[model samples]
Target: MAQRLLLRRFLASVISRKPPQGRWAPLISRALQTPPHSPGDLTVTSSQARPLYTTRVCSTTFNIQDGPPDFQDRVVNSETPVVVDFHAQWCGPCKILGPRLEKVVAKQHGKVVRAKVDIDDHTDLAIEYEVSAVPTVLAIKNGDVVDKFVGIKDEDPLEAFMKKLIA
Candidate 1:
């Protein structure tokens, strides 16, 4: 009788040690039911489609207009010198220059402000500035156009010109 009692107690302990099958079984089954992510199922959001650096430049590029409609307030009125990049989407030279200027602008954010004008969109400003070509970069200081570059130029010269204006 004692042997039988001992066997029953051991069986009870073993059964108790095993989890209630229904409790976790459903959860595990549900977890496994989720389909694995496939390459074809992946979708890239705008924010995630580009790299961090590219996203940064795209965000920092500013748009500005020309003439007396608070142009000075936006650019020249600022404490820092302004570098305006006149460009269009279709211009290859503008495309190359845009990124280079963006890097420079980012590096000199506090000291200088970088602005971009889309000539195609802002034709009045383009005509006022006599922007005959795309990628015309102008350095404005104290409400006056101080230095201008008609084409893609090295960052060193641009930086040097901006430093002089800011100084």
Candidate 2:
């Protein structure tokens, strides 16, 4: 009798066709895929391998994927000062410097942005930028190279250098 009553109640609820309410509503809607979800599909596939430092492939924080045109568009033409890090995968100093530079850049907030260029991926850009070394950093402002350093600088010196660029 209780089972029958429960079945009848469930049938009545389904027949009413009213929208789900409260906490479980979202889970149910998501499971059914009946209602539209905004922000599109936020799913990452196994085939897509993101970097260890960043979650998304295209991140806005410090590491940027700037090709020839993107480099100009985002770094060179920007109102804010830009620090272009020219590096390679096999470089030891670059691996060390990349994170350290990012930490300092984060302290500056919106004042500065870092664009990383993989020399192996974009050999043309490396040659154009005249990056003979693995860890070459360039500071750009007003569409020109204002300052630059070609080595793995410690946190203090790098921070000081960054300050000079923004100042």
Candidate 3:
């Protein structure tokens, strides 16, 4: 039953929707059709993967999906500064960074928003932002990309990063 559901999702993503166009259209299109194999490709698939971190921060943290419209509404249009985390389900470092990012965002007590973007589900976002790797965090303000970083960061750095964004 699970396998069938997974197949449905895969087909819907690939067949029903049209590919986004832009400078990265060709690359994104190719990637969608021929996704690269993960290190444990045989044992794990992107659909089967779940986030290792699950701490909630008072609706301040939300997942961004459905391409440009969603991102524009949640992140770009948000009154508060947005910390956009571009990560993949199968990424190891992302699992560690996600919770920590949430924790730091929560400290602000709604001053900032944490927007999680699954690179696999929103390749156009990743490509638009020039994200070449997983676990990239961007600080956005008033629909503009203000700051960004890649890879996992410790609590102290994460705190400082948030501070800078809000400041």
Candidate 4:
């Protein structure tokens, strides 16, 4: 009971003190002066501006096995060069090489993008590209195949390959 009375007295004294007047006082007052709104009205804060996930978000690499049409759009028609990775689930070398290639490609920033295709999932693309083996990486530019390599490559080889593609 004593603590509660003391706290109340302290709060009352603090409340009686006026805040310092400044140039921002009018803006603060205006922001605090919210008018009546309907239930459908929406309010957004800077923290809630962007979504956690968005389709247009850029990434170093993405899967292209779902839609071949979109693959053509992203790779062939792209203004930037694209690296096409043809791999399969059962291919041991592919598992080792995919992430390494993505890491190397990321260093290029927006100069290049990677479109990964699972040979098992997209057999048509594999056959169309004449991919006879797994871990076949192709560098494409201006809708044409520029450079290619088959099998797993180490970090140095991968970096060199990406450098050639951007050049």
Clashing pairs in 3: none
Best by lDDT: 3
lDDT per residue, candidate 1, 110-130, as tens digits? Answer: 677788888887888889888
Q: TM per model?
A: 0.59, 0.63, 0.65, 0.65
Per-residue lDDT for 1-167 in model 4, tens only? Answer: 34533443443333323552588756544443334567775543333333233366568788885667977888889989999999888888889998898888888887898999988888889998999998999999999999999998899988888888888
RMSD of each: 16.9, 12.4, 18.2, 11.7
**Per-candidate clash tally:** 0, 0, 0, 0
lDDT (0-100) at residue 75 of candidate 2? 83
Q: What TM-score does candidate 3 get on C-alpha atoms?
A: 0.65
Lowest lDDT 10-residue stretch of candidate 1: 45-54
State the lDDT at 93 in candidate 1. 92
Cα lDDT tens digits for candidate 3, 62-153: 98868889999888888899999999889999999999998899889999989999989999899999999989999998889888999999
Query: Residues 23-113, candidate 2, lDDT per residue (tens digit)?
Result: 7877645543423335763432223323233343433355446578887788878898988999889999999999999889888866888
- How many residue-pair clashes does candidate 2 contain? 0
Candidate 4 worst ten-residue window by lDDT: 45-54
Instruction: Report the backbone clash tally of model 4.
Output: 0
lDDT preference between candidates 3 and 4, better one: 3
